[model samples]
Target: MQPPTLSLIGTTPRMRWAWTAAGVLLIAGWVHRPASAQEPAIFRGADLKLGEELIAQHRCAQCHAEKVGGDGSAIYRPLGVINNAGLLRGMVEQCNATLNFQMFPEEVTAVAAVLNRDHYRFKD
Candidate 1:
């Protein structure tokens, strides 16, 4: 038996043009889609490894545990006031300033990015 194939027989030029246009549009949409759709724009190109290291170095979990009374994981609330990526970064910056961490802007972004990856999962 022969494999089935699409038959263009008797198809009008307008119909063919419509199909071609639809295909082009579909392909263009896919091709033009943002590559970092899975990651927030603020955290793009952030150093996740450095973020992890800084988190550990800063004893963030220990501090959180002291404040919240637990493993410190409760400090991260995905649906809380810090819901979006920008807000999340802002929160990190606030912490850096309040704690006198003296972290650079990129370092703050890196920390926020790691927190987003592990806890918040904010994309955008």
Candidate 2:
């Protein structure tokens, strides 16, 4: 026997619209799911070793120690106002600018990411 015709499959505009909507939803989901997942997590793919090296070169911990006393870790208040990834990165960038560390953008990001991994741990 032959298969049902398009007229028989979707006799009504509502039925056709429903199928269209379902198709749209499916395609939209297929397109969007990967995009959302593809977005790199804060601190993802960071070079920890380079970050450490840069921190040492910049005397970041030393300055912090002088500023707050102790190993300088005390200067990084995990519970203080800088509680987000963007803020954390921004703080590092600001420090980079003010300190004139001349760190590249990626270096700054890597440094901030390492700091986040070690102390901040800001989850999206």
Candidate 3:
């Protein structure tokens, strides 16, 4: 009886180089992947500072506080009906319309991005 054996000794130099390159590429892809890749595409390149400023300037927290009480963060409802990134952004747009904020499309995306980063944390 003979025991089975595994060997890479037969592999050519080119084959070994190819395998090494593949491994390096795979590792690099995982390492360089953007953290925001999981977030909705609409959130990409959004101005977070502008969003925070708008949120404060518009007194969103103040209004929410008046409606839901406390710091007003309770209205977020991560598990509530306003689930998903698109819906969250849409809600912000709705607020903009209803409040007559007249914010530009990028402004809406900014606000939604800030909200997603802080409250909703929607992945996509």
| Predicted structure with the largest TM-score when compared to the true one | 3
Span of ten consecutive residues with least summed lDDT in model 3: 1-10
TM-score of every model versus the real structure: 0.72, 0.65, 0.74
Tell how far residue 57 is off in model 2, in angstroms.
0.8
Clashes found in each candidate (C-alpha, N, C closer than 3 A): 0, 0, 0
The parts of candidate 2 lying over 4 Å away from their true place are 1-40
- Per-residue lDDT of model 1, residues 1-124, tens digit only: 3234444332568777888889999999999999578899889899999999999999999999998988998999999999999999999999999999999999999999999999999878
| lDDT by residue for model 3 (62-122), tens | 9999999999988889899888888999999999999999999999999999999999888
Task: Please name the candidate that would achieve the greatest lDDT relative to the true structure.
Answer: 1
Alpha-carbon local distance difference test for all models? 0.90, 0.82, 0.88
Q: What TM value does model 3 have?
A: 0.74
- Whose lDDT is higher: candidate 1's or candidate 3's? 1
RMSD of each: 3.9, 8.3, 6.4
For candidate 1, list the clashing residue pairs, or say none: none
As for TM-score, the candidate ahead, 1 or 2, is 1
**In model 3, which residue pairs have backbone atoms overlapping below 3 Å?**
none
